[model samples]
Target: MEIIVTPTAEHLELDAARLNSHPQNESRLFPDGEVYVQLESVADIESALVVHSGQPCPNQGLAYLYGLLDLLTKHDVLITLCFTYVPYGMQDKSFYPGTVNYARALLDHVTRYPVRQVYAIDPHFSHRDWVAEYPVSHLHAFPLVQQRVNADLDDYVVVGPDLGAVERFGIPSYEKTRNGAYEVELEGGLDIEGRNVLVFDDLIETGGTMVAAYDRLKSQGADTVVAAAVHGVLDEGIQRVQGTYDGLYLTNTIETDAGNVATESLVQTALE
Candidate 1:
């Protein structure tokens, strides 16, 4: 399959697409607030894309993606997408009527094209069945996490921070109460005295949950309490997670400082 890394997704440096080959892939804007885009040499081929929908400019990213899709769909190219960081993925649920589930909304918009499959690294969703009708599948980052832990971390047990994580990872978990968007309280017991603890989850936004987990584990006499997550989207989290924990391990999904694992290999894992 011919692979494409869109102009919006150029920062990932995936081996699949060579940006230099498509010198004509450029963008401009109209006098009005509109975007003009062009992607060269991607027509009439089966293709895979690499892109991340990170913030501060998410609308621009999707606009560029839609541009590329418009050009490629002309020749009926089969497409697969690697959304490294899904935009608005955390908004997967709605508690009230008329509340939009942005996750589902984005999925609908993404599948409007002839996409065969979609691979995301540990997508944040409350349930899988809610999106089973879509061609989206999660790329498990836990295997890579296990490899990293086995190579560097010793005498540590993987602990899920809440029931959702417990169901996803099938490990011992902590009871958590969320007071607000940035406030977290954890309650649980484990025989972890003098042993290292690794709290695993999909994403961390404000770092409140991880910090609460760290405090709970340390209070139980654990030697080291580390935080591990696939996506490090720390908007206001760097301070809360940096000095408070023994260590933080994350993947290159969002290009954060704590990202130690390369998600390139894990992308290939999706094909398997």
Candidate 2:
């Protein structure tokens, strides 16, 4: 029931007050570029939940993660790893001949350490078999983001950016057309005319999908468009989509100024 946070996870500001609190874990280099880890207090722990933000700085963050995992396994502590934004998550869908799936490869590397279970928030992987093996627990920030956002907002509809989402969310979604403008066919009994639109995806690296959805929704006579996602690895995407959408939000999965929503509720239930 103890929560051990990595340096990168500090951005999440996770609300795990219900879980047992322990001394912070420390990490530094050995001058050879190798990572070293330590517990601020004595390591008499039994069960632990290691929360880490694994994007933006995957290599450095992973060094800390592996070091911490190595240290904990020595104490025979039961571990459940939580990566707010799973690394190498994008390559799980479709494969190229003679190439390896980095997503599965890296996740396998993680499971190598005596880890019991791993969890992530809205992983980008769509490969059914790979996802079935170890997905993000099918947990998402949609409901939480929806609940926290202003309810007095305009009439809203969730736009699935892909066919998988269109089937999954059972709502009208947008697809790309030959002309580069997104097309919304108005399925699932929801129309974009004069109503606010909400479109989301697992990750928002460039914000093109969201911004495009906004443009298409407005073209279809929608009032306003709110863009959202679970992870906002938004390097330059933030500046690009800032003023265009009526609202923009990302869960605090990565360390960014724009992560307005929190991801604690989705995780607490599993830990307890």
Candidate 3:
């Protein structure tokens, strides 16, 4: 038997509904915001699949994951972690003085557990040395976003929010653009005038650059602006832009109130 555990029931609801035979743990939270797992009593459990939707409280989620690992390891069960959004993944570099390598730190901490494998979606790390303990499956977010974009939107041009995203969205060189904290810069002097645009990025934390780019595209006469990302860690960024955007679509990676595109199938395949 394979048991699926997550920090919250909501995180694994879609998966559980799909995999009806797999046993699962429902997480409960105390008044103090501590997380606890309620496991269904079973025998002959061979492995534990810990699914994590790293948002709202990533540390608390980690605590639950660690606790589950401890319990399962005592029974000599194999363990795998399917973390949709790696916490502090963007902190891959010490940009300047007083900065810490949070990516390394987080990877180091998680690998301390006896995890047989780790699965993540488009982790931002440029190096893989931190994950030396176990094999990691790095999944791409582009195909997921592309399928949704093609199915939902018509008459839209995909806009990469940064130079790095140009290849991901397959935008033409002339159409490529770059977004900074407060300004949007054109790579090939392209104009978004009178065109419907879809802004794409790997993740949305604070939504600063995306918001700025949306406003700038409108200023340059874009007919409509929509956004899509792999992870939606909105962090007041969605509230900051309120009613201005036509739509916002995201995968169930970090789990916000955004329109969710299913990723449970991806998770199932990863487990296999």
**Model 3 C-alpha lDDT per residue in residues 1-272, reported as the tens digit of each score:** 35474644256445341112223433266557766654544235677666776675877877766666676677777778777788777787777999988877776766777787888877766344655544777877667777887787778887766655654445532333445553445434346788888887777776666776676677779887888888777647665544557887787777666636767766776667
Stretches of candidate 2 off by over 4 Å are 14-27, 30-33, 40-42, 150-152, 167-170, 177-190
TM-score each candidate.
0.87, 0.83, 0.78
Tell me how far the alpha carbon of residue 270 in candidate 3 is from the true structure, in angstroms, after superposition. 1.3
Q: Which run of 10 residues does model 3 get worst, by summed lDDT?
A: 17-26
Highest-TM-score candidate: 1
lDDT of 2 by residue, 1-117 (tens): 787788778655564312122334332655576656676432668888888777777888888888788878888888888878887777764477887777788788878887778
lDDT of 1 by residue, 1-272 (tens): 66676544455556665333323434255557466665555554666554554543667767767776677677677777777778788888785898988888888887888877888778887355688888887778888877887777797888887777876667888888999988888887988899988889888888888888888888899997877888778746755777787777777777665678778776665444
Clashing pairs in 1: none
Higher-lDDT candidate of 2 and 3: 2
lDDT of 3 at 167: 43
lDDT value, candidate 1, whole model? 0.74
lDDT of each: 0.74, 0.69, 0.67
